[model samples]
Target: MFIRTENFSQYVRAYPIVTFLLALNIGIFILTWIPGIGNQLLLFGIGDNFLIANGEYWRLVTPMFLHGGLTHLLFNMFSLFIFGPELEKIAGKARFITIYMLAGLFGDVATYFLQSGDYRHLGASGAIFGVFGAFGALVYYTKHVFPQLKQVILPIIVISVVMTFVGTNINVTAHIAGLITGFLIGLSYFNPKNIVSWRKKR
Candidate 1:
């Protein structure tokens, strides 16, 4: 179910939400590389608890689109690329974006309240983790009907948790918060019948 066989145009047509997200992320990252304004954008867009506390609340939203470096961007976008389509297809565009934004916002809010005043973060990892969390919720709700699906997501979850700890300079709070938020949102947002209909399409 995760393997993407679609070509460029095909993939875009099939998963417009994921396509738009990918484009927006990559585009923003590119804009961040443009010398002068790049650093300025980073300073302005990064999530700084100090700035946030001072009422620069947009930090919560902008960090979802900012990344520290190429590896950071690639990793988060790769995760989104891999795990996003299924959820987008199942949740539909509106619901999918809602879960993604809420999960990301929740993570950023957690970071603002949990971390130090000086702590700063800029990346889409929280949102990507939310995608994983949504998958978990889907499996949890549909397990009896789709027991075999667990085999697909369980390993990914394990690897993600392990990587979160093993990696350096990670925003542990955001990851955990995003995961919880996504799962909770999924619990309330997903309809079993919708999932069934989505599965039938597959």
Candidate 2:
């Protein structure tokens, strides 16, 4: 892990959105280790759970910080570790973070609206998919912009999407919502005029 960190820092800004996101995720995970903290956090997840019974409407976001188990948490974090830096490089820190959190938020919203009662869900899969979708848009857009990068980047998008879909125990709805959300964000942000506007604002 330390070697990976050293390598990551050598190439990109260590304190970028990726790092912040990872920290937020791991920090929240640690907090969940506290006896009542995890249960309390679980209340806000998308499901027919205690949070739902208690009317904790804010759990949509809160649940995102909690995971069902270690395997679930690790998978999400691994995806973030793998795809995050690349996506951050393309979208930059602020936009990347915005897309990630919004995508997760959107995922939970979709979950809440689509599902029936008595089921709850949580994880950062939504945000991970968002990152993946954004990276896909980068490829789609870059083929026209940089053209040469397609050889490498296009495959990354395909494999990532496939992994998201094929993986077990994934919340497909959240992934789909996140993917669509990310694609839209990428398209809007990369639009010629919007890019100019975005650049100017930044």
Q: Give one digit per residue, the lDDT tens place, for model 2 in 1-202.
A: 1124446566446536777778888988887788997667565343554455467778677656677888888988887877777566556678888889889888888887776555578888887888777766766665675555567656666776787679876677888898888878887666565434433542
Which pairs, if any, clash in model 2? 44-59, 47-119, 47-120, 48-119
lDDT of 1 by residue, 66-128 (tens): 999999999999888988998999888988888899889999999999999999998888888
Best prediction by lDDT: 1
Model-by-model lDDT, in order?
Answer: 0.90, 0.71
State candidate 1's TM-score. 0.97
Model 1 CA lDDT for position 169: 96
Residue 199 accuracy (lDDT) in model 1: 83
Per-residue lDDT for 183 in model 1? 84
User: Which residue runs does candidate 2 get wrong by more than 4 Å?
Assistant: 1-13, 44-55, 144-168, 191-202
Judge candidate 2 at residue 139 and give its lDDT.
61
Give per-residue lDDT, candidate 1, residue 18.
93
